[model samples]
Target: MDETWAPEACTLPTAERPFRVAEFDDLFATHLRRSERVDPQTLDLTLNPESRATVEDLTARETECCSFFTFTLTGTTELHLRITVPPTQTAVLDGLLA
Candidate 1:
């Protein structure tokens, strides 16, 4: 796994993080339409409507390992995702974008 940016608080096993990251990269490559950093601690993503299941699954597994994230997925036709982390975890969120 690429532990270079992964925070110490992440519970995802070191070996599995690369796979998780690959999934995210694939998701972004395939479905991400737009990405915005709403604030220092928040990120908003716009994805294709066809990405609902993938987003749901990825976010679910992500939260299981990094509970600090708060993800809200909405928009029936367009799929909007809002990801927020607490102030203390802002750096971790930034790592994801990198």
Candidate 2:
């Protein structure tokens, strides 16, 4: 991984209340639908369903190196996601705005 692409430190807010894994999925799906810049293929989620807890939330903040995306699943909220745009698709994303 390139040093420039390293993820930055960030914190996400805890969910208002406890929710099941399925509830988290529904929230994630709704977020995806509302965001035009986000693609389904680029958003890959690996959640542990066995460990259930209350409070599910997410927060994003910018850093000096790269933008940080974090998810708060259950009580623990330290999930860091690193997203990479392939050379081929890089052009596609750029062209969309241009």
Candidate 3:
């Protein structure tokens, strides 16, 4: 895989909070309302109303560690999170979101 997205310096230490598979699994299992693949490298997630803060917090922390991730939230009554990653990192993104 191309290491372009994995920069040497970042805001958070990856080793401090290694990506936990269960964390994501639980987040999606409990909060996901609907999901769509905006494209091969972008995922659009519409989460339950109550899950907005949780998702925001999670993504915020994620952005600290992996600057490659682009997380955007649009809409108010119904929140949507658009997660974009480099094309070369699709597999890694899939594994994390799966």
| Each model's lDDT | 0.90, 0.31, 0.72
TM-score between candidate 3 and the true structure: 0.76
- For residue 27, give model 1's deviation from the true position in Å: 0.3
Specify the poorest-scoring 10-residue window by lDDT in model 1: 1-10
lDDT of 3 at 68: 81
Per-prediction TM-score, please?
0.94, 0.19, 0.76
Best candidate, lDDT-wise? 1
Clashing pairs in 2: 18-54
lDDT of 2 at 45: 38
Query: How well is each residue in 1-98 modelled by candidate 1, as lDDT tens digits?
Result: 35467777789999899999899889989999999999999999999999999999999999999898899999988999999999998887887877
Per-residue C-alpha lDDT of model 2 across residues 1-98, encoded as one tens digit per residue: 11222212312222312232234445444432222335622433333332233213232222221233223333233322323344434432232212
- What lDDT score is found at residue 54 in candidate 1? 95
What is the full ranking by TM-score, best candidate first?
1, 3, 2
